[model samples]
Target: MDTNQIVRAVKTPVTLVLLAVLVYFAANWGLDAVRKPIPPRPPEPCVVQQIGPELTPDHVYVRVYNGSKTNGLAKRLGSVLSADGFKVVKRVNADRDDYPRSLVVGHSEDSPEVALVRKALTNVDFMADGRIDRTVDVIIGSEQPGAAEQPDLKVPLPDGTACLPKIQTVEVNE
Candidate 1:
């Protein structure tokens, strides 16, 4: 073969070999990056949600807090609230532990979600804190209230539009 023919034949193979090596290395690097471990994500606290006229226990989002000296009171009440069909997203100790009576705190005392929770417990009173988010905080005081028997789970909102806490995956940790 002539010199040009030999050079063309050698150049094609060399070019192909270099291209194959480049592609293989790039693929391996990409896969390694993809396989790297991803850190766990923290849970979101709460979000305001708008719902229809009727409010049910399932639609009500709650965070139970222990304001009493009793240990695990928040966790126990959270479970009871969950069993009653309320979406209990969090259970934690309150900032204070000297509450004399359990209180339900919400954006407004007239909120449907607050009213439903208030009806489900005994010896509880409503306290409006004007929180923007519609999450109803149930603070268990030294005199914790017992769940009402056959409490009404569904109630219609007199107002056309109602804002409540967006239901999230349950996080029953203290």
Candidate 2:
């Protein structure tokens, strides 16, 4: 047999094998890309509070009430509480829509969860109810501090505590 004929015969099979390999890889790559699952989207970041507590947030079932007219204030506060580990069961509007100050009211004075809820929110008042349920009611008032569209209450200082220096009248030569 001629050498050129042998070479030509060998090249056909070799080229066919290479083409097969290339086609195999291309099909696999395309199928893998289509079959591969897309990574799930990450959840929204929670603003968890750093208040260490004897009890976890799940221990307290909080019911948030928007005592003020501020839209979504109770919901926002509820989200903060939920992020902090508190068990926020409900968010609703108060029966009376007029509230001057926010309050954290427990089911009873002996209720143990009020303190934990209050600890998350330092600048609010608290109350005790006579009901026999395990729930904490957070009434968000118009003056609720640390919320948007309103400022926190200013702290009262003792006399001479102002940063400005006192001025005294001085006699000057004309």
Candidate 3:
């Protein structure tokens, strides 16, 4: 009926609507601030590594022996092996010349240097001795002529048997 009354009536409804909208947004923002943030994702799993045995040829002392009756064989082999980075400690005649093929005698079969030396040489047999010294005995035979070669400095890799670690199995019930 009156202009002031009409203005006041419209203003009350508009103010209530505006206040309701502001309160709705403020309540939502307050709830978001109180809520916990998402945690960072866990790092990816890593592979487990197993330590393996290693042997160095440069550190291994070698003794060349002439299993063949051919003269100057041991000295020649010693010279060649020395040039190839092998530490030739001595060059001498073997106790006997009965060996038909060359031989690589190592103190232990599990050693890394033994595998490396055995792999490099041709037509050679391996022998394990009880001697505590880490010396490798190379007996040259008459059959393997021109067998002296450059030594490979890299250590030989272990076999699959050496790599397989013991694993336990678990049983789960549903």
Q: Which stretches of candidate 3 lie over 4 Å from their true place?
A: 1-54, 145-151, 156-174
lDDT of 2 by residue, 22-108 (tens): 999999999999998999854232222333433445556678999998889889998988877777778989997789999988755
Instruction: Give the winner by lDDT: 1 or 2.
Output: 1
Error of 1 at 113 (Å): 0.5
**lDDT winner, 1 or 3:** 1
**lDDT score at residue 128, model 3, on the 0-100 scale:** 90
lDDT of 1 at 70: 94
TM per candidate comes to 0.65, 0.51, 0.53
Using TM-score, rank the candidates from best to worst. 1, 3, 2
Model 3 per-residue lDDT at 34:
84
lDDT of 1 by residue, 1-174 (tens): 999999998998999999999999999999999999997764344454456667888878899999999999999999999999998988999999999999999878787878889888888878998766678899999889899998877778766456654444567988
Per TM-score, the best of the predicted structures is 1
- Distance from true location, Cα of 46 in model 1, Å: 9.2
Each candidate's lDDT (Cα)? 0.84, 0.67, 0.68
lDDT of 3: 0.68
RMSD of each: 10.4, 18.1, 23.5
lDDT at 86, model 2: 73
Candidate 2: give the clashing pairs: 57-85, 57-86
